[model samples]
Structures are given as C-alpha cells and as structure tokens.
Target: MHPPSVRSERLVSPTGRGYLQLESHPAGCFRGVELMRAQVPAPDAPPARRPTALVIGSSAGYGLASTITGLVRYGIDGVGIGWERAAGQRSASAGWYRTIAAATIARDLRSNFVFRNADAFADSTKSETLDLLEERFGGVDYLIYSVAAPRRTDPRTGITHQSVLKPLGEPHTTRNLEFADDGTALLRDVTVEPATEAEKAATVRVMGGEDWSRWVTALAGRGLLRDGFRTVALSYIGSPLTSAIYRAGTIGAAKEHLESTAVTLDALLAGFGGRALVSVNGAVISQALTAVPGIPLYVCLLRGVLGDRFPSPVEQSLQLWEQLTADRPDVDERGRIRLDRWELSAAVQATMAERWRSVTPATLTELADVPWFRTQFRALYGFDVPGVDYAVPVATDLPWPGSPAR
Candidate 1:
C-alpha cells in the first residue's frame, strides 16, 4: 500500500539553490520531536483534574510543542488536528512523522492521543474532530488555535482566500538572506510592495480570526464545550526592524482582527467561566516565518542579540501553559498574554537595531546567528537533527497508530 523503504535526502530548489527544503527525513523528524519533548520536565505532581484538549494545526512548530507540553507536563488527553501528506513517492511531511512520534510518546505515558491529518479549515474536518471529542472525551476543556496557512477555503461560502505579506502604506526595503548552491549565505536588499485592498482583505480572510471564531462557534453549537473551557490563538508582534513588513503589514491587519475576535469570544464564553486569549509569542524559526519576507533576517538578528536566552517554541509554549493555567493568569491590559517580553525588551531591541544598521554580507555572521538560523530552518523539515543517522533507510509510509478518523 506504500512505497518501499528509502534513504531520505535533503532536496532544495529545482534549480538546486535556495532555502526551501523539498523533502523530509522521518528519522530526523522523530528525533526532533523527542528533543522537544525532553525539554519539558514531568510535572511534580499530577494535575488536579485531567483535562482534554483539542489542538488545531498541531503537528509542527509551536502547535506540536504545545501538544507535547500538554500531554507530558499536564497529563492531558488530546486530539491533534494537522493537515499533512502521508508518505508516498516523496516522503511524508515532517509534521507527519512528528505526529507519529508524539503519538508513540502519548501511548507510553498512558495519555489518550488522536491525530487527524485533514484540512482544519474545512467543515468536514471540524465535524469529524468534534465527533471524536464527543465520543471519546465527552467535551473539550481547552482549544488551541495555531493555524498558519498560505490560503484557506471558506467552508461556508465555498470561496478561497490567499494570504500575502506586504506592507500597508509604502513599499518596504530590507536586507534579506539568500543561499547559494553550495549553501553559502548572501545578503541582499529586497523590496516588497504594498498589498492592495483586495489582497489585505484576502489576507484577513485566511490568517485572521474568522476561522477561529467559526471553530469556537461550531463547538459551542454542538454542545461540546466543557465548563471552564479556555481557548488561545498564537500571534506575534515583532521589533521595529521588521515592523513595517510584519506588525504594520497585511499580517498585522489580520492579527488585529484576530485580537478583536478574542474579545468577542471571551464575551461569548463568559457564561461557562471560559476565556479566549491571544498570546503574543516571541519570534522563533518556523516554516511559516521562513516564507514571509524580512522575518528571517529579524529572527536571526534577534537570536544573535539574545544568544542563549532566545526561547524556543517548546519553551515558550510551556510558559504559556503555566500562565493560562494559573489561578490569576498573567495578562496585559488587553487581556493578551505577552510571551515576547524577553525578545522585545528595550536592551534587546536596541542591540538588534544597532546591528541591523551596520549588518552586511561581510558582517552577517558576526551580527546574526546565521548558522543557528540555518540549522533551525533545516530542522523544521527533519534535517540536521542530532543523533539522526541519515545514512540509514527509513519507512516513509508509517500510519497513525490509533487515529479514529484518519
């Protein structure tokens, strides 16, 4: 039913020169999951109540980390929803392998874990997930919305919306990183034009809070929300260096919509003692960010400025869980969690800005953690993970062990 075992190799651009990785290594992906899970210490004591969670977009990046943290640290049962390709002629998506590894760990910990490899934006996917939650867990106590997509098809309207990364008022010119065929890093100035009104609207449709609201609405309509239910959506507000291209751009407009949705959802859930919040997370290397203009440069520079203090996706997710579960959750004036406080500290921003002004091809290595950035980028697709023997052949067509609706 699947392809034979093969030794996975790193594939790049069709022209053989670019930052895009075209293939995934299952072994490395499993190793990556293990590494992240290792960072979360087991709870000192069992939780007061074992909660059930539903993690949308829960296969990679912060979504995956949050899943692992919830399962391992809090002994939470979960249904993780992610859209990833199963292994075929090429390899399964890195997220596919990560889900398998996570499922294995959950089994060992005696936690009920279900993974659904289906479109999170579709009504069918939501219905199927809700069915599983109703059948197995009674209802969901926590909902984590961490979807990052280039486009989304509105299940209700049968219309598709694509997201764009462009500034609002004027074109933004910034230093960007380009990799040579030999993987040498090069600096170049790239100019990104402003998004049209239609494009801005499209971006909000794809990346904004509409889908999150829909999910919550669907769950509420199905009577699947447990008492004291809590929901969170991940967001980012970067430093001024990339603000024009990020926080002030089309994505920023979408984030504003997302934040406003949180306010509405909080009010909607008030009767159940539930809350909806947006956690402004720190910048971390993610597949979604790599595709965005100027984010790579900003993240690299941020890492260099923070050095060892830079928080990983898993670390930040663990901290987020602690805060959300606290008796008096720490939140800003807008009722948003601020996990980017370290990255946006005055001293960190000042140093990053100074380096940004003088950074060039010659000084990129000195001013930014280029090597770390590259490694992290590769790790997203299951490459360069420590202890993974790439020489060995791996079966790419592994199936989810106990998924009910895959």
Candidate 2:
C-alpha cells in the first residue's frame, strides 16, 4: 500500500473569478485575486489587445495606475512621458519617483514599456520624445496628460511664473499645519497668508492649460498622433470649504483654464478624429495635494464617508481606461467624456459635506484617528508600496526626473 498522500487546497480568484489553489504564500495571495480582478492573463497575448499609448507623468499615483491599467486591464504596451533631468541637482522630484516605479512595475508585468524621460515642458525634451516615438512604436494611439508642476516658463515671453496656493480675496486665515517627525498626526492652527495680485496671476498662468494646448499642438504638428487618437488631462472641482484654497483659489483658476483648453484642443484634433478631454477627478491624496491648505482635514473627513467606495488610484485609472476604450456613442455637447458626473456624485458629496461639518480640532484627534492620517500621507509618495519592504534602504542616489523645462 502507498503511504498516505498529503494534500492541501486554498480557495482563490483568477481573472477575478473564483478558483481554488493549493499551497500559495499568504503574501502572494492577492496575486491571483488582482490578476483575475484586473483581468491580466497568465500566458500573456490571449487576444489582440488595443495598441498601447504614451502616458505623461506615469510613475506614481494616477499616472502610474493608468499605466498599469493600460497593461494589465487593457494589455497595451505603453510609453510613459516624463522629465529625468533638471537645472539643479536635487534628485527624485515627484516625477522621478513616478518614472522609476513605472519602470519597475512594467518590467515585472512583462509588458513592452518604455520611459521617455525628458522635460516635457521644453522643446528639446519634446523633440527627444518625438525621436523616441519614431524609433519605438512609430506612433502612439493615446496620450494621457497628467503632468503637474508648481511653475511654468513661457518660451515666447521668456517669463517664469512660480505657482502658489494663496486664496483669492482678502488675506485668508486658515488652519496651520504641523506634522509629527514620525509623520504620524498633524497639528493645526489658524494660518494666514496675504496673496499679492502678481502671486495670484502667476499661480493661474502656471497651472492653466496654455501649456497643455502647446503640447497637443506640438504633437499634432509632428504628425506623431495617429488618427482616432485621444488625450486626457486631469482637473478638479471642489466644495465651498476648499474653494478658498482649491476651487476659487489660484489652483482653481488654473484648472478652469485647463478645462477650457480641452475644448480648444478637441477642436484642433477634430480633423483627425482625435479629441482632448478633461477629467474632473475627485480629490486624491497625492504628494502635491497634501501641500494644499486644509486638505489634510478634508481628506480625513472625506475618508469617513467614501470608505471603500472611494476608489484608489488603480481603480480610478481602470475607469479612465474603460472610458477611453469602451464602445459608446454618448457624447455631450461639451466634447468631454464626463467622469466628473460620477466624481461629483450627489451621494458622495452629500456624505462628504456632512462629515466636514462634524470635524473640528478637538474632535479630529479621535474622529480621524492617527493611523489613518499616517497611511494616507505615506501613500502619497509610494512609501507604502505593496509587497516592498519599507525597512529596506531606498537609495537616495537614484537619478530623479525633475522638470528640466522649468
């Protein structure tokens, strides 16, 4: 008689469909689930997937998530647009971090991806990008515009405008922000800043869609954009509380311009069946967003309401991909694929407003909780990268991709 055989079985999810697997590491369990849920194939090349495109700012947050969605969810080999060099020697601006992470993820996923690391704001960088496009895939089918910066320099005027977060109207006194050394909890006091007219104007000019228009025009001029090509840029519309710092503030002005720029670009691309859309996304906890006044409290408050329904970067990007690829005849007169309709959902916003009312300095400590704040803050910079050991030394010497165009 044979010795008693040992067997083990574990329930699993593939293609996000339910299955059972025997003997898998606990840490790796999410693999089967994520793969199935996201719908990436094990053998790869199951069906002819949509031709991939180029994504600017494709290293972290929404940009990174979009890149992954292109590969895993859509099975498209994508090129990320980024800036790898700067005037000064400060390594690892947010963009650099994004590019590095994108490269690593692309490699792991066995996707044919390339990082077109250059100053996207500069003509030289743009030329280099064109060269890369010519050599690599001949052309890109989609362009995701997710570039974010605090300043912009006009090549024509030769004037540089540094962006700021000061609110419009009178000297705005808002909460002061002080974070613990351990990056745990934040302490707030009423902070005040007087915005000069020039400061406000500079903020708008830098954040506005003037540059976005230039980019689309440049790409079209090069004849690099394929017919039926599309591009998307992210925008935001916030509430009254945030209006001082976000919506009605300097950033808000810029975002308004950005939205308008989309319409203009759509007209420009209409000839080739190309279009530009502005995605007015919900507020996410990005590195730059954390710097905004009152956003910390806003995030904490929103979290209580959004709960699990508030999508993560990955989910958001997946939705964006679906919007880009799905067969739909619906087009609004505004010429935008309106994700903002869902973003500004009445249920979500109503809940957020209620939560906002309940938050205060005294109650915040207990209501928000320390761990939640820490997690959100750390998540901003890819610090809590899943499956990566946080204790491991991340090299500072890594060449950062800064906006050399700035």
Best-fitting candidate, scored by TM-score: 1
Show pairs that collide, candidate 1. none
Instruction: State candidate 1's TM-score.
Output: 0.95
List candidate 2 segments past 4 Å from native: 1-50, 84-98, 108-110, 176-178, 182-184, 192-194, 329-335, 338-343, 382-406
List model 2 lDDT by residue over 1-406, tens digit each: 0111113322221111111111112112122123223533233444365576878777545776777677665656757876544212222343454454445556666677878765566767667776777687777788888877777777678788899987777666555334655444555655547577898788778888877787777778877788888888877776666778788778888888888988888888889887788776666777567778777677666666556655666666766777776555234575555555544678867866775666565666655544565555543433343564434333333433222322
TM-score of each: 0.95, 0.79
> Model 1, poorest ten-residue lDDT window?
8-17
lDDT of 1: 0.86
Candidate 2 has which clashing residue pairs, if any?
A: 15-36, 16-36, 16-37, 59-98, 83-118, 84-401, 92-400, 176-189
